[model samples]
Target: MAGVYDPSVQQLRSLLTLAEELHFGRAAARLYLTQPALSLQISTLERRLGVRLFTRTSRRVEVTPVGRALLPLVRNIVGATDELRDAALSSLAEGGGLRLRVGLTDCATALGATRRVIAGLTTRHPALEIDFRVVDLVEQVTGLATGRIDAAFVYLPVAEDFHIQPLTTEARVACLSSTDPLSQRASVCLADLADRPMVSLTPQVPRAVRDFWSVDPRPDGVPVRYTAHEVSRVESLLSAVSFDGARAFLPAVAAELYPRPDVRYLPVTDLPPCTFAIAWPEADGDAPHLALLADVCRALRDEGLPTDPPAPSPRTDPDASVASLAERQ
Candidate 1:
């Protein structure tokens, strides 16, 4: 008995290309092979299969009935082979070690929890390398979309195309100058700030986000007045409030992270809390390690170990679960 012969992927690839082009020269050019080489591959494939695959005339080339029948099968094989190759390459990359590029906004990095999250992630995946980039609020979205960063820790109300995993939600506070009378109050409301000059962020920040931070309209339906200063960085915004007698709203964590003798953070009693989340491209949401990172964040939050000193209980804690906060609102 004779042994069976298996066709090589290179031969099948040649056959597939030839079937699509139906021109020996064109197929050869596409495959980066000489016409004779392509012809030899087709001939070899036909000989092994014991079937004729093409009918060649001086004018044109046509696939024989057998060739037509095998065309779809060959295409499927090639597609599957390519998928296998890609999977193998991915596995190799993971085995050798993988790097995740993460973006962080100024406020996000200011969180003590952010550092702990990164530390936990590294401990969990010893083979993983992290590349952290600092991006501003508006640039975080663009960075994820452009593949400049794989993931980011950012505030909520971003583009709908991103997949957001909420990490923490904290109460918002008003940043005011120590000289301001409002600074004496334990807490303040949007109505109290209705006539005050609020520091406006640059136009690059989304209008909705800016509106929310500016506390756009007083609870009584009056528009919050804007100061002449338009700033971009957190330091600049704080400086404007500290020296210019302007006011701005920030996440409560900002109060803890950036304490200044000249600035006071009074809780905005009636306003909703600011939600911080991990955002990634919706397309790559399920890619390996992202879920693990989210899990680590959740664990850290649950343990109350996210802050510098770590809160003792959820009741006394300033941080709350993203899901629970959303549910309440």
Candidate 2:
């Protein structure tokens, strides 16, 4: 077999550095370039490679197998290049450069541990530059797919083929008005909401929403008059719910994020918990950025609040699964 050298050595160098640093902003700083410039360089490398090297979610980053395999080779090449730099530095007595860029969802409060991970990258790689982009879930996915984004913190229900890195776990809680008669109770059970109207963040499944509110083995199918996607729209949602005397199912963490004077949060006892994972494309290649994001996500996970929301009742069947709810729907 013949040895092949990439003509895009500078591009390759940047990619390898990104893989090592596992973050864009830090890598960019090291390169002495703006974050966008650094991102363009990595994007260019991916374009030439003809294969995707990374996967990202709003919460974290990941490297494909291709990225992993390429990392060591990249390190070796960069090291060799560093030796060349050392020779030049010895002669001229000059410094070098480093940088990195990071992408994330605008919802910073929701990202928990991922924030610390970025800080670590900057501290450990002082020479590196860090750049961050606030993006949405879909945009984050597209970024990883097309190489525009190195890594991100994203929600679940992503492509299965991608390598998923779990950052933390969060269970759902029902957000209700404090003024509601039910809110007077310390906690509320799923069955308690049987006939009550509700608000929801467009459910992954209509059945899932129905199941959450159903007390009977079969759902009575109460109407969800309000649906929303934006977290900021909770005020409007709350207004809608209040008008209808409805309650909404939300992640416990999310519930606390918006503390309405008129509303309170209660866990849906005996419900299955939702786990948020940071996913990346699965392939063998060197991807430094993705790995870096994953580390950050894990750190965020460490700071995560308890996944266990207060149970509706100890006597309630813990065995009750979402599948059971799915069955009725």
Candidate 3:
């Protein structure tokens, strides 16, 4: 490249750091280069850029007015360049058609948006291959932490260690078999079904869900009684083949995931709405696919679904509902 505006990133960084530190020795220490080496690099940069970037004396080192003006621009440029390099590395990891593995714990309220994010990422960044996995909340957390998965569809509140981005809120509902008498009602309340045999998430319910159910307080401080989790359980415990009168609390997404002829989903008028987020390891920090997926998720959340989701019933008490009741078990 001919010299009109040709700039070496290394030289620009050295200049920027020297300006920032205002001390040759300190700047060299920060850059892990010797002071003389840094000085030489800075001199070379000034020569190449055809400008005096700094004025130096034994007493002090100072950026010139031109250098000061250029400092902010240089910082932004260098920072952006670093980000670009990281992103390029990330793309290379994704480019070989490796699966951009995506995982979901219990379904969240924003399934529609989640689907759109996947579609958009795949279409916009065709080099990435995406595979979606459905596991429980604990497994999702462990997978992200261990780098076994790139991103997880998580319902808040996730454990503190993982980074999360909110997607959407969903109303909590009670799912039942169409054959059940409660299915005849347009809506159901927790108090109304208090005595009914509930298909409780047998495993420890995720903290967020427990809070939604108000596990600490009951009308009579009565311990909530429900059926335990059973393997091979459909989203709703009730199915044509497994048609047991078990009612489970779920978000709109879960209901949609396992739509069944024999089962009916009814709004729970007594619970608050649940929120969901996309989660990945804090360790993954800013993995590009994760970052891009988060961006795509945000876009999908803002623009909304390509097709309208079912009308959310007004009977639900959004304040108390949880998003992924499947995690409750």
Candidate 4:
């Protein structure tokens, strides 16, 4: 327990928001508070909890191990609080108090298209209460299929049952510790990481999902090693790569969305690219709001897909399915 020091719901939301933004200024803006105020809240939160929730420096901020493990629970609390707050509101102009809940598989990713589409939706229907719920990968699929979620952005290799829209298929990049020898190179091939142990996902993950992420069936026929550490959260996995002697293969989008001083993302020359898509069930195909979302997606994607690494690739981006984390662990 936190003793007699109790934090308000808004304070907790501030913690969640800051963890998502990973920047004091941006997180403050989102909460409509000044930078100093946000700093105070975070400091107080850390002091009260007796744990350092985030690591910060002049260049970047990152969630600490404790913070990553606590996120799923924190998110659940925040959602319940928001739902209660909304129920107390008597009226809305357009949405009439109806909540459009969209499930996100990622907790912290700055995706461009996701931002624009959400922005467009807000501009067009300000009255609609959009609850962007961060959940696990299985939940992302199950939630949509069962109507627990209005829609979701999921990575490729998913079941064919859902109506899907191809978003991005970017090259897979190698994630390594900044201090590792390979980090000195600008680019790397899969062979370079043959000896490094990789962070493992939860055991329940399907074999296909595991194989794709682990780069199983290597071109060189080299087997991979697994670290003792297993993570379901992206932050935790990144932490492993940074502090532990581990390596991973992730979508190229990570180079930007998750810039870290202790980690280096090098494009892998030999691995195949992974795809991400926005999906919904056939049952919701005719929903009015979903129709608007579909139209917005088409227009925005046609303009161009997200090109990651600040380098020109055919199509890429944290921009496409920033939801790639969908906790696809």
State the lDDT at 205 in candidate 1: 79
Q: Per-model C-alpha lDDT, please?
A: 0.73, 0.53, 0.64, 0.68
**What is candidate 4's lDDT per residue for 1-329, written digit by digit as tens?**
54567766667878888888898977765565689998898889888778888999999989999989878987898778756534433223264545567777662234454566677667655666788988675677668767889878766665667777655556677788878887776567788889888888766555577678988867889887888875766778889999996998877666666777788777666677776667777777767656656655644443444423233233232223222322121
* Runs in model 4 lying further than 4 Å from the true structure: 1-98, 124-127, 301-329
- How close is every model to the real structure, measured as TM-score? 0.60, 0.48, 0.56, 0.57
Pick the winner on TM-score between candidates 1 and 4: 1
Worst 10 residues of 3 by lDDT: 320-329
Scanning candidate 1 in windows of ten residues, the lowest lDDT window is 320-329
Against the true structure, candidate 3 reaches a TM-score of: 0.56
Return the lDDT, model 1, position 131. Answer: 89
Q: For all the candidates, what are their Cα RMSDs to the real structure?
A: 17.9, 14.5, 13.7, 19.8
TM-score, prediction 4: 0.57
C-alpha RMSD (angstroms) for model 1: 17.9
What's the lDDT for candidate 1? Answer: 0.73
Prediction 3 global C-alpha lDDT: 0.64
TM-score of decoy 1: 0.60
Instruction: Give the C-alpha miss distance for residue 227 in model 4, angstroms.
Output: 3.0
lDDT of 1 by residue, 12-40 (tens): 98888788789998787556568999999
Candidate 2 lDDT by residue in tens digits, 198-225: 5544343334333443222424444434
